[model samples]
Target: MSDTSLLSSLLNLITTATCNLQSELKGAGLPEPWIDNASLHPWDEETPSKKYWDARRTLISALGMMTAVVQNPREKIICDDLGYHHSAALNFIVNTHMADVLAAPNVDERIGLPVSEIARRTGTHPAKTERVLRFLCMYHTFQETSPGVFANNKVSECLKKGHPTAELPLMWADVGFRSATAFSATLRDPQTAHSMRIEDAPFGAVFGNHTSKSTSESESIPKSEPGTASPVRATIFEFLSRPESEVYRSAFAKTMVTLDIMNGALGYHDLPWDRWDKEGAVFVEAGASTGHLSNDVLSVVKHAKFINQDLPEVCLQGEKFFAENNAEAIRSGRVKFQPNDFFTEQPVKGAAIYILSNILHDWPDNEALKILKHIGDAMIPTSRLLVMEIVIVPSLSQSRSPPSAPVDQNPNDAPWPLPKDYGIVNRYPHHQSMEMINTFNGLDRTLDEYVALFQQSELELVEVHRIRKLVSIMEVKKKA
Candidate 1:
């Protein structure tokens, strides 16, 4: 295809997708979400129908491609260089509570808060605050109603103090920013590049392990098996548990809550909960921090009991959370907290279902194998292990049309002009795949990779249920 023809094809795709999305919204009697509005669109407040979701995904995918194709190559490369600057500016805005100041009840949305006032409230320099707001304004985050004055727009409102997505920016900036900046260095360094050890990840490269004990002193800690990269120091999880890292630990916990809200609770909807609904059914969630997933599950599987297992400290926190938020479940003995390490033997044998949500991706194949083996050892013939994770579909594929989704299937195929798996619309898994590498020297895997890993652990992948666009329930059982 000629360059001009390809460009036209892209434009046509964008137009068609946009029209479809708009028509769906209008048909549903919903207002189209606008970037400039401070209030969330009605659709944002609730889940949309499947048709609406498909249309919206199509539009977003096409638009993302159109953006890349239209921008000059040189300009795109230059702009990409300042990705770090964008992160830094956003970090500054969030850390200084700029969004909170602008969204305060007394603050006028039209007039906006002056940079001086915002700076005073946040204890920052006025001139510096203005520059950060202006930079963010260019990206349609905060809006500048007048020179040196800013207010929360739809994009910025999510970062307000108590908003659902407020901790996302904080988490990404504090946990990921430096690691991302040091990506090249970590990969280029011979010591870390080929290493599969979690301790050798970009986080460790940027900020060497903070734990005081040496590797020799910490023999009780889990070590990589032969052929796996050995730990040079403590991993991020261990560091987060230290008494001195209390502030970061608190922030990390809140960040995870925001992460859950962003990921939604629908990922568990498609699983075969009915089959296990008999009385005395047990669901054990490994590495379950604060038991949020299990709590959500309690609402769905009324007859099943849930046990949330995690580190001792996190188990304590989960107990408090259950007491305050799900007292009835705890009081009724339907939900319980167990402090246990997944690396050790499986304590609760023959649970009806076991869940390892977003846990395996935090370790490499070798370490992940150990985790799987432990879980597999405890599984009976009827016991099922649901590995809730992203099963990465390639962004580019041979299919030129959306793959057919049978009543029982959730195909991720994309149409022509938009790469398969909906291109940038499906970047969450890819971004998270890199995040795993950056933070833990781990990675997200394709279905084939998972199948191979499960086989090695003496488990079989019996079924797959794509629950959300970015998450799937890989149902496995003990090998026959």
Candidate 2:
């Protein structure tokens, strides 16, 4: 092979290595001290500068391999080991209604549901369930306190759907929407006329549309006209929307309520209300799909107002979750709920804080801006936007410009921003997140892009904090 071809071959090896590591981390178990940082505000997960640098190095090496595949397209494997684990994890949860079964507290070990008994309750082929249980043992999502017996742990508790502590955000992103959309979508068809002008990826077909603008206006956002059929992470209608019946909807709703109650009990431990409170507080869960995040927000904030928003079609669950819960709470009087389609509407005045925790990074800038502009419009002078996100930092080893000017300077004076040379792009968690969100045309973001998004909205970056090892806290204020 030619030297260039040979170099590409070496890079391929690197990509495979990186993907394996990513999967290992996910299966390794959820981060420790998780209960402590559940409501991750800024400054929740602090570490030494050296640790950040070490992690940045590992991230760059991983992402660099993945990005190379984007351009070269040939020398790589799509489903690294992590992809397999993700599927395994989802199947594991679904079979036992793992989330529900786990929520029953000590009932399992208390009843001594050894592998045979667990199989009996779930009504599974006992031998097969035993095989799966052995897999769970390896991951320790459930603990085998004694041989043959299983019970919940911090990680297992989170598996319950609708549990606020549940990273339903993560789970829903994977099996929830992608699986459903893939039914009729052409996820890997890179040969359409639109690939040249990528705006053409069929909305229904869009799988991995992750993108970043030229760090400078000189580096323009690739042009693509808006199209119908936007991607959603997942909505509450899995039960209703699929079969198109009220019974399914009702069942899904009940599941959601059960989830909510479990999450509240498991999640109340790390509510981050004290350390970071702002003046104009509004968190527009733009793709609030069914109001799960809004429910989470309501838990932390009695004073902090929320903008629970999503597509009009998907808005019912927000109402349902609140209405069902509040009916009981009203006699008790606890939380309030509001619904809006954030893209079309969000309150934009005198706001202290606005949040898009698991938003952004979903679209190529082509669509993300419309949502950001709405968020910007809602900002008051003192308001700040708090995003609990996975920000990609640039790789430290890559050579770059000296620090004399800002890393994002423009050569052509074209109007837009670009990624900075900060070496953090790979810090994002869940290697498969890009592939999973592909079902929705949703992409991930780098720290540089977040800065640019804020700039477009005339917002300023006041502070940036890291949550756990994978998530980040970006605090921003409307620019003066």
Candidate 3:
């Protein structure tokens, strides 16, 4: 079809989908998600509404597809493909505390602030601040209320100090950005390219304590002992565990909380928590950082004993977290924090439910298998394992033939297919997978891979509950 015809067809499809979504939202008595001031906030604060979020996802997908078709291919590829510039700008804003400046109690939210004021408060150059703010404003993160005066919008508000998600961007823009730079090198280095060892990954190569060496020399160097203090031998987690890395460790923990928020309380939505016979049931939260997931469970699934396990330092923090947030549960002997390494053994045995949220994805298969084996050893015949993680969908091959035109569809139908594996829906996860490989030599597995992992532990995969676009709850049990 002609370019103009294709554009028209896409526009029609977007319009129809958007109208239908709006109607559904109205019927459900939810607020309209306006494009100008969209509230993509988590729905966990209220009752979990799958229908509402599903509608929102549909609208977002359609809008994304429409945007792709509307942009000039050359400009789009150049601007969108090279995202480091945007990341750098955002990193600058985060590191300099520009968002905190705008959010100060004395600052007028309506009047906004000029570049001079923002730069002064942030200790940045006025001209550079203007350029960065203008770029961010274009992306709808910050807004220019008047010429040269910027204020926080919903998007920028996320960066305000003490926000639940504030530390997430910093994690990405700092360590994530640095690790990404070494991605190309990781791919090209024969010694490291295909290696699943954490020390061989780009993140290790960049931040690791090892001395600079050529690929050949690196081969001769003895592998650093796990949990050792050697500068050259420490894994990402080990490095972060050091006394000097306390700032980064705190940020990383907060980032996990942000991830949970982003997933819209997936565990609660996907798992049948209400139906679970909670009377005297033990819920073991393995690798529970700050006890956020355990807190979620305590809020919903009452009368259950909770064990929050992690490394010693993390368990200490989790204790404080539960003390501050769920003091009643701790006071009543329903909740306890235990410091136990997953790699060592299953300290809590035969729990009714063991939750491994975002844990296995941080390790390679070899390490992941070891962790699984420990969990399996702890499981009773009736115990269920809830492995919450992203299930990556394979991408279409470039060599595959172009999608054929619909045989008998209305002309107003979407010009492009709306398959779940379409580029727009899959891109974020794909990027995440790459980051996993780069940072930890880990992976976001497909369903089959997850099943295989469970099978290795002599467990049976009962079901997979999709919680969101990038996450799922793979339910497993001891093999009958």
TM-score of each: 0.88, 0.53, 0.86
Worst 10 residues of 1 by lDDT: 214-223
RMSD of 3: 6.0
Best by lDDT: 1
Per-residue CA lDDT of candidate 3, range 97-146, in tens? 78788778887876678989998887789998899999988888888888
Task: Tell me the spans in candidate 3 whose CA falls farther than 4 Å from its real position.
Answer: 1-9, 27-30, 34-48, 210-231, 396-416
Residue 397 in model 3: lDDT: 26
lDDT of 1: 0.77
Which of 1 and 3 is ahead in lDDT?
1
- State in Å the error of residue 361, model 1: 0.7
**Full-model lDDT for every candidate:** 0.77, 0.48, 0.73
Per-residue alpha-carbon lDDT of candidate 2 for residues 150-238, written as tens digits (9 for 90 to 100): 66555565556655434443334333433434423444443432331223333333222323211211233323223424453222222
- How far off is residue 396 in model 3, in Å? 4.2
Model 1, runs deviating above 4 Å: 2-4, 23-29, 209-232, 397-411
